[model samples]
Target chain A: MHLVGLQAENFRNFSTVQLSFAKHTNLITGSNGSGKSNLIELIYYALFSRSFKTSEDMNLLHWKESYLRTQIEFQRDGVDKTVVVSFNSNKEKKVLLNNIPEKFSVLFRESSVIVFSPSTSQLVKGLPSVRRKWLDRILVRVDREFTSILYSYQQTLRNRNALIKRKLIQKEDYDLYDLLTTNLVSLSSLIRKGRQDLIKMINAVISPTVSKMDLPMFSSIELKYYHSRMMEDPSLLAKEEIKRGGTLIGAHLDQIEIFHGDASVRDFSSEGEQKLISFCLKLCEFDLIQVKTKNSPVCLIDDLFSELDEDRAQLLFKYVSSVSQTIFTDLTGRLIEADKVIPLTREENTICLP
Target chain B: MYEFTPSYLKAVEELHQLPGIGPKSAEKLAASFLKMKQEDFHGFVEALQELREKVKQCSRCYNLAESELCLICSDPERDQTKLCVVEESKDLVAIEKTGAYNGLYHVLQGVLKPIEGIQSNKIRLKELFHRLQHESFQEIILATNFNYEGELTAMYIVKELKNSSLTISRLASGLPMGSDIEFADQLTLKNAFRGREKFSEEMI
Candidate 1:
C-alpha cells in the first residue's frame, strides 16, 4: 500500500495542512522549523503509531495546542482507505480506518515504512544491542511468530537475573541458580542463533549496498555477528555469575560487531559515514522485507537532506526516490524533488501545498 | 525502641518476613495498622487469618485448597487414572491455567534438591506412590519447568517408575505452544528435535 495524500493538524508547527503524493517519490522541502521533519513524524505516527524521536505524544502536539490530529489516505489491494487520529486533553486518542473505528495494531501490517532519522545513526556505531534490535524489529514485523520467541527469550533473561540476585543474597538457594543458569543457557543460545541468521540475511543485502556506496579506497565495510557465550556452557556461566551481581554472559550481553576494513567502524566511522552505513543497512532490511513479504514498504525520511552532505544527499535522494511511496523533509527547500510539497508557511497555522 | 501490642507486633513481624520488605516497611505497616479504624484492622486480620486457616494442601496433588482436597482433585468429573506429575504447586497452576489437562495431577511439592535438604521423601512423593497403587493410572506425563532441577526431578521419577507398565512422557519442547521455526534458537531446537520420541503404541 502507498500513501495517496497526507494531512497534518496542530502537530508541531503545523496547525492544519493537506497534500497529495506520487506513487514513486514525493519530496517535502521547507526551512528549519518550517515543520518539515514534523510532517515526516506525522506520517510515521499514522503508519507505526510510534514517535521515533521522543516518547511523549504531547511533543507531537503543536506548542500551546492541547489537541492535535492527522488524516492520512493510502491505497491497499487497489482499494482506497483513510486513517485519522486525534489527540485530546487526557492524551486519549482514537484511530479511524476509512471512516470506521479500527484498532491501531490492525493498521500495522497493511502498510510498512522504514524511517531514517538522526537518531538512527546510532544503529551502526552506538551499541551492539541497537544493531540486534535493528535485526529483530523487522523480523518481528514481517513474521509475527518470531515476536513471541523474542519476548519469551527476554522474559527468561529477566527471570534468570532475578534468580542470580536471589541466589547471591541466600547462599542456600542453589536450585534457583541452577534453574536460571539452565534457562539462560538454553534461551540465550537460541537468541544468539536467531541473531546469526538475521546477521547473515542482513549481510546478504548490506554487502552490495555498502559496496555500492564505495567507501574511501583504504576503508572497508564489514558487518559481523558475534556470540562469545554461545560456545560456553550456560550452567558454568551461572556458577561464575554468583560473583557477578548480574548475568552478563547471555543474549543480554550479546554484541554484533561492525567494522570498516581493519578498524572498528563503531569507533572510527565519521558521523556521515555512520549515517550512510545505518541507512544502507536499513535499506537492506527494507529490501529483505519486500523479498519476504512480496510488498514494498512506504519510505519516510525526516530532515534527511540536512543530515546528509551533498555527496550522500544525492545517494539518499536517488535511493529514497526509487521506493514505492516516499516522503522526505528538509530545512532547505531546494534539496530532493517531491511530486508534492506542503509548505509550513509562517502566516498559516496549517499546512498547504506550495 | 518503642513498645507495641501483640496485634501490632504481629503486623510488623509479618511484614518484615516478606521478600524485599525492610524494617522501615515493617514499622510503616505497624503505624498504618494503628491509623486504621479498630473494625478495619479487625477485618484485615480476619481476611489474612482466613488465608492461613482455610487454605489446605490437597492430600493427592499438593494444590492449595479451601477443603481437604484441591478443587481439581475433589472435582469428581476429572479423570483419576491419568496423573500429570509436576515439580511444584506453581507448575500445577500453570498447567491448570491452560484448561488443557483434565486429568488428576501429583504435585511433588518440591524438586530433588539434594543441596537444599529436600530429598525425594521431603515432598509429596510417597503420597503420590500410594495414590498410584490405589488408582489405575494409564499414564504419568511429566510437566516440570524447563530447567535443570525440573529435568532432574523428571528423570528421577521416570527411572523410579520404569518397572511399571504405565506410559511416561515429557512435554514437547521443539516449539513453544505458539512459535515459529524461523526464530527458534538453533541449539535448543536441535535438542528438542533430538529428544522427540517416535509416536507408537508403547511410546504413547
Candidate 2:
C-alpha cells in the first residue's frame, strides 16, 4: 500500500495543509518545532483515528481552534481509498472510510502501518508490559484472532483481579475462583502461544537484518521468549495467585529478553548498538507485516536519522527505500535521498509534492 | 426557533426521559402524536398509563407481568428442573423467541457492577438465592450476556450456588449461524474456536 495524498485542518500547529506523497520515498525536513512530527501524526491519526504522541484527542487540536480534521487518500490492492478523521472540543470524534462511518477495528484492518520514532527504543529497554503491548499490536495485525484472544484475556484478568480485591472468599467463591483461573490459564496460554510464534518470526530476521547493517560491535542478536509461570503447574500458580491477592502468572508477566551472546542487550549494549537493534526490530516488523498481509506497510520514520551514525543512517535509508513507500523526517535533507522533499516552516504551512 | 405549546413541550420533555430518546426524537414523537386522531392519541395515553399501573414483577421469576407469575413461569410445560438465569426480561424474550430453550427463566433485572455501586444484594440476587434453596433444580444455565458485568454476575451466582448439587453452565458464545468465516470478526472467530465441538462418526 502507498499513501497518495494527505490534508489537515486545525490540526496541531498547522491551520491547514495539503500534500501528495511519492510511491517510493518522501522526505520531510524542518527545524525544531516546525510541525514535522505533527505531519506524520496526522497520517497516523487518519489511519488509526488516534494520535501516537498523546492519548488525549484535544491536544491534537490547534490552540483556539474548536476541532481538528484530517483526510488521507491511499491505494491498496489497486483500489483507491480515502479516510477522514475529525474531532472537536466537545470530545466527539468521527472516523469515516470512503465517506462511511467506520469502526476503529475496521480502520485497522484496512490499513497497515509500521512507525519508528525516537521514543520507540523503549521497546528494547522499557518494561515488560511495553514489550507485551508491542508484541500484541503486531500479533493483532498478523493474526486477526489475536485481538479477540487478547481482549478476552484482559477481561478475564480484570474480573479475576476484582474478585481477588473483594478480600472475602466464601466456600462457594472457590468454584468461581477455579473457573476464573481456568479461563485465565487458557487465555494466557493462547496469548503466550501467539507471542511465541511472533517472536520466532522476529528472531528469524533480527540476526540477518542486523548483520546486513554491518555494525561491527554486534555479531549476533537473539530474542528469547520468557514463558509465564502459568505454563507450569497452573494449580500451584493459582494458589500463589490467591495468596498474593492478585494474578501472579499470565501473559501480563511474560517478557521477550533480547540478548547478544551471553549478555543481555538492554543491560550491556552501547547506545549505538541499542539504536541499531531497535531499527532492526522495526525492519523485522515491516517484513512480518508484509509477509502476513502480502502488502508492504507504509513506513513512517520520525527523526530517525538524528540518532544514527552516517553508515547506519545510509543502511536504514537503503532498507526503507526498498519498501513500497516511506515517509521520514530529518533535521536536514543533506544525507537523505527522496522522491519528494517537503520543507515545513512555521510561517508558511504550504506543502509541495515534489 | 419556533415555540411549541406548553403541553407539547411537556410531552416532548417526558418522552425524552426514555432511554436513547433524545430531545429531537422526543419532539418528533410529540408532533407525530399530535397528528394522530384524537381517539388514537387517547388510546396511546391510556396504554402508557396502564403500563406503569398494571405491570407488576412476577413473584416467581421477577420478570414483568400482569399477574403473580410471568407467562413463562406459569406455563406448565416448561422444564422447571432446568432454570436459565438472565440479566433482564428483554433477554428472556430474546431467548424465548429462539424456540431453542424450553427451561424456565429467572430475571436478575441487572448485573453486578461494583464500580457503579451495584453489588450482589443490589439486584434480585437475594430472591435468587432463596428460590434456589427452596426449589429443586437439576441444572442451572447462566444465560447472561457475554460481557464484563454480565459475566461477573453469572460468576457471582455460580459462587453462591457452589455447594448445591445442580450442574451449572454458561450460555455458549460463538459465531452466529450463517456467518461466513471470512467475514466474521476476530472475537466471533475466537469464540467459535473456543466452542468448537468434537466430531464423531455416527453413520458416516
Candidate 3:
C-alpha cells in the first residue's frame, strides 16, 4: 500500500496543503523552512501518531494552535482509500477510514512504509536502545505478536515495580512473578530469533546498497547483540535484580554493539557517515519487510536531498527508486528530478494555515 | 473561571473530565442521571459505592471473591496436585474460562519492576513459595503474560521453586507469543495446555 496524496491543516507550519503524488517517484520541492519538513512530519504523524523531530505535541499543532490534523489518501490492491486523523488538546485523537470511524490499527493494516530522515542518524552511531527499537519496530510491523509482547512486557514491568515499591507480599505476587518469567523467556527467545534473522538480512542488504551507492565500504556497519543471554543462565540476570532493584537480566538490558570492522562506529563515524549507515539500514528494512509482507512499502525519503551532496543525492535516489513508491522532499529545486515534480498548492480556502 | 450553574453545569464539567467522555458524552450522562427517578438514582449511587466493598480478594488465591476464598480455590473437587500461577485475578479468570485445566491457582498481586523501585519483598513471592513447601502439588504451571518483565518474574519464581519437589512446567507453545492467557484465543489456550511441557526435572 502507498500514500498517493496528502492533505494537511494547522499541522506544523503547513496550515494548508493538498499535494498530488507519483507512482514511482514524487518530488516535493520548496525553499528551506517553507514547510518541506513539515509536510513530511505530517505524513509521519498521520501514519505513526508520533513525530521524528519533536516529542512535544504543542509544537506540531502550529504556534498558538490548539489542534493538528492530517489526511492521507492511499491506494491498496487497486482500491483508493482515504484515512483522516486529527487531535486536539481537549479531546482524544480521532481516526476515520473512508469517512467511517475505525480502530487506529485499522488505519495502518498492510499499509507499509519505509522512511529515511535526518533524525535517523542515530540508528548506527547512537545508543543500543535506538538500534533495538529500530529492530523491534520493523519486526512488530510484520509480526503482530512481537508488538503485543512488547506492550505486555512494558505493562508487566510497571505492575511488578509497583509491587516492589509497596512491599506488598501477597502470595499472588509470586504467582505473577512466575507468569512474568515464563512469558519473558518465551518472548525474548522469539525476539532474539527475529533479531538474529534481521542481522543476517541487514548483512545481506547493507553491502549491496553500499556497493550500489559507490560509497566506501562500511565495514563498521555491523550489528552485534550482547550474545551472553543465550549462554548465561537467565536466572543469573534475575539474581542481579536484587542489587539492580529490578530485573537486570535478558533483552531489556542486553546491548547490541555496532562496528565498522575494527573501529567502533559510534565514536569514529562522521555525521554524514552515520546518515549513510542509517539510510542503508532503512533500505534494508524495505527489503526485509517487502520479503515478509509481499508488498512494496510507500517510501517517504524526507529531506535527505538537503543533507547530501549531488553525488549522494543521486545515489540515494537511485537506491530508493529501486523499490516502492517514494515521495521525497527537498528545500532547493536541485533535488527535484526534472521529470517528476509535484507542486504543493492550496486554493483560496481548502485548508487554511495557522 | 468559567461561569456555570452548580447543579447542571458542575456535573457536566466533572463528567467531561473522565476519559473517552467528551462534552457530548458528559452532557448525555448528566442528562441520563437527571432523567432517572430519585429512587433509581439512589440505587445507582449505592451500587457504585458498594461495588468494591462487597467483593474482596480470596485469601487462598487472590481472585476477587464474595466469600473468604474464590470459587476456584474453594472448590474441593479441583486437583490440588496441579497449580497454575498467574499475575492477576484477570489472569486467573482467563485460565478458568478454558475449563481444560482442573487445578488450583495463585495470583501475584503484581509483577517485579526495579526501575519503578519495586522489589520482591513487597509482593506475594514468600507466601507462594511458603505454600508450595507445605502442599504436595505435582506441578506448578507458569502462565504469566509473555513479555520482558514478566519473564524475569517468572524466572525468579521458577528458581525459587527449584528447591521444591513439585514439577515446575510453563504453560505451552500455542498461546501465541507475547500475550496474556487472558487475551489468548481459545484454540491457542487449548494448544498451550496440550503443549504443556516440563522446564526441567532438576528445578523440582
Candidate 4:
C-alpha cells in the first residue's frame, strides 16, 4: 500500500492544497513554519481519524475557519482507494471511504503507518509508561484481542483500586476483592506474555536487521520485559495496596528496559545513541507489521534525518529508500538522490508546494 | 432574552432540561407546540401529566408499568420459571421485540460501577436476591451489556450465588449476522474471536 495523492482544505496553515507523492523516496523540504509538519499530520489524521500532533481536532482548523477537510488517495495491492476526513467546530467528525460514509475504524483498519519523529526517542529516554504505551500500540495493531484485554485490565485495576479505597469494605467483601484480584493477575499475565513475545521478536531481529542496514551503532540492542513483584498473585500485595489506597501490582506498573551490550540504554546512552536505537526500533516495527499484516506500511519520517549527522544521515537515507515508500521532511534540500522533492513555501494563509 | 413569550420560554426551559434536548431543539419543539391545534395541545399536556402521575415501577421486576405487576409479569403465557436480568427496562423491551425469549425479566435499573459510587446495593440487587430466595426459578439469564462493567456485575452475581442450585448463564457476545470482518469494531470483533463456536452439522 502506498499514498498517491492528498487534498486538504482549511487544514492548519493551508487553505487549500493538492499534492501527490512518488511511489518511492520523497522529501518535503522547507524552512520553519512552512507547513511541513502540518502536511504530515494531515495524512496521519486522514488515515487514523485523529491527529498525532494535537489531541484536539479543532487545533487542525485553519485560522478562524469553521471546518477542515482532508482527502487521502492511496493504492492498495494496485487498487486505488480514497479516504476523506472532515471535522467541524462542533467537534463532529465524518469519515468517508471511497465516498461512502463509514466508521473511523474502517479507515483505521484499511492501512498501517509507522511514524518516526524526534519525539519517538522518548520511548527509550522517557518514563516507563511511554515505553509501555509504545509496545501496546504495536501489539494492538497486530493482535486484535490485545486491545480488549488491555482495556479490561485497566478497568479492572481502577475497580480494584476503588474497592480498596472503600473504608467500610467489610470481611464479606473478601469475595469481591478476591474476584478482582484473580482477574487482575490473569489479565496481567496475558499482557505481560504479549509484551514478552514482542520484545523477544524485536531482540531476535534488532542486531541482524540493523547490521544488514549497516547502522552498527545500534547492532547490539536488546529489550528486556520486566513484570512487577507480584505477577502471578496480586493478592500478596492486597494489604499494602489497601494501605496505599491504590493499585501496587499489575501490567500498568510493568517496565521494559533497553540495553546496548552491557550498559543500560536508559541511563548511559547518549542522545545520538538513543536516537539511533529509536530508528532501529522503528525499522523492526516496520518489519513486524509487514510480516503480520502482509502489507508494507508507508513510513512517515518527520524531520528525523536532520537530527542525525551527515554521514549517518546518508547511510540512513540509503537504508530507508531500500525498505518501502518513505516520506521525509527536512529543513535543508540536500537529499540529492530523492525520487521527488516538494519545496513548500507559504503565503499568508496558503501553502505552495511546487 | 429574544423576547419570546413567557409561557413559550418556560416550555422551552422545561424541554431543555431533558437528556438530549439542546436550547435550540427545545425552542423549536416549543414553537412546534404553539403551531398545534388546541385539542392536540391539550392532548399532549394531558399525556405528559398522565405519564408523570400514572407510571409506576413494577413491584416485582422494577420495570416501568402502570400497576404493581408489569404487563410481562401479569401475562400468564410467559415462562415464569425462567428469569432474565437486565440493567434497564429498555433492554427487556428489546429482548421482548426479538420473540426469542419467552421468559420473565428483572430490571436492576443500573449496574455496579463502584468507581462512580454505584455499589451493588445502589441498584435492585437486594430485591433481586430476595425474589430469588422466595421464588422458584429454574434458569436465570444475565442479559447485561457486554462491556466491562456488565461483565463485572454478572461475575459478582455468580459469586454471590455460589451455593445456589439455579442454572445461571450470561448473554453470548459475538459478531452480528451479516457483519463484514473488515469493518467490525474492536470490541465486537474481539468478543467474536474469543467466543467462536464450534461448527457442527447437526447444529446446522
TM-score of every prediction relative to native: 0.66, 0.86, 0.70, 0.90
Candidate 1 global lDDT = 0.73
CA shift of A347, model 2, Å: 0.7
TM-score of the second chain in each model? 0.80, 0.90, 0.73, 0.90
- lDDT for predicted candidate 4 compared with the true structure: 0.84
- Per-residue lDDT of A316-351 in model 3, one digit per residue for the tens? 787768667877887666645643675444322233
B1-204 per-residue lDDT for model 4 (tens digits): 469888888989999999999999999998898899999999999999999999999999999999889999999998989999999999998999999999899999999886887777789988998889988898999999888889888998998898999999988887788879888877777778888889989777
Question: Candidates 2 and 4: which is better by DockQ?
Answer: 4
Lowest lDDT 10-residue stretch of candidate 2 chain A: A167-176
CA shift of A345, model 3, Å: 9.8
B1-204 in candidate 2: lDDT tens per residue?
Answer: 889899989999999999999999999998898799999989988998999999999999999999999888899998889889999999999998999999888999998764454566668888988888888788999998888778768877877777889899998888887878998866777778998877869635
**For candidate 4, lDDT tens digit of each residue in A1-354?**
899988889998889888888999888888888888887888899787888778988988999999998888999888899999999999999999999999875565688898878788888898999889889988888987887798899888888888889843664355667778779989999999999999999898898768755787777789988888774444556667778988787899998999988899989988988887877787788889888888888988888566666766676666766867888899886754678888887554554443
**Better structure of 3 and 4 per lDDT:** 4
Q: Which prediction has the highest lDDT against the true structure?
A: 4
Order of models, best DockQ first: 4, 2, 3, 1
lDDT of 1 by residue, A1-354 (tens): 688877877877777777778787776666565666777888888665567777788788877888988888888768888888888767898888878887776676667788877877889778777887777778777765566567666655665565565454443345445554565677676766777777777766666665555544322466787665553664566567756856666676767887777788788877767787777777777778778778778888777766767777677667656756777776665756666665565556665653
Q: Candidate 4: which stretches are off by over 4 Å?
A: A100-106, A161-177, A231-239, A346-348, A352-354, B76-78, B175-204
What order do candidates take by lDDT, descending?
4, 2, 1, 3
Docking band of candidate 2: acceptable
Q: Compared with the true structure, what per-residue lDDT tens digits does model 2 show for residues A122-202? A: 878878777788889998887777877787788777767766666435543454556667777888889888998888888
Candidate 2's C-alpha runs over 4 A off are A164-166, A169-178, A227-249, A350-354, B1-16, B23-45, B112-119, B129-133, B148-178, B186-204
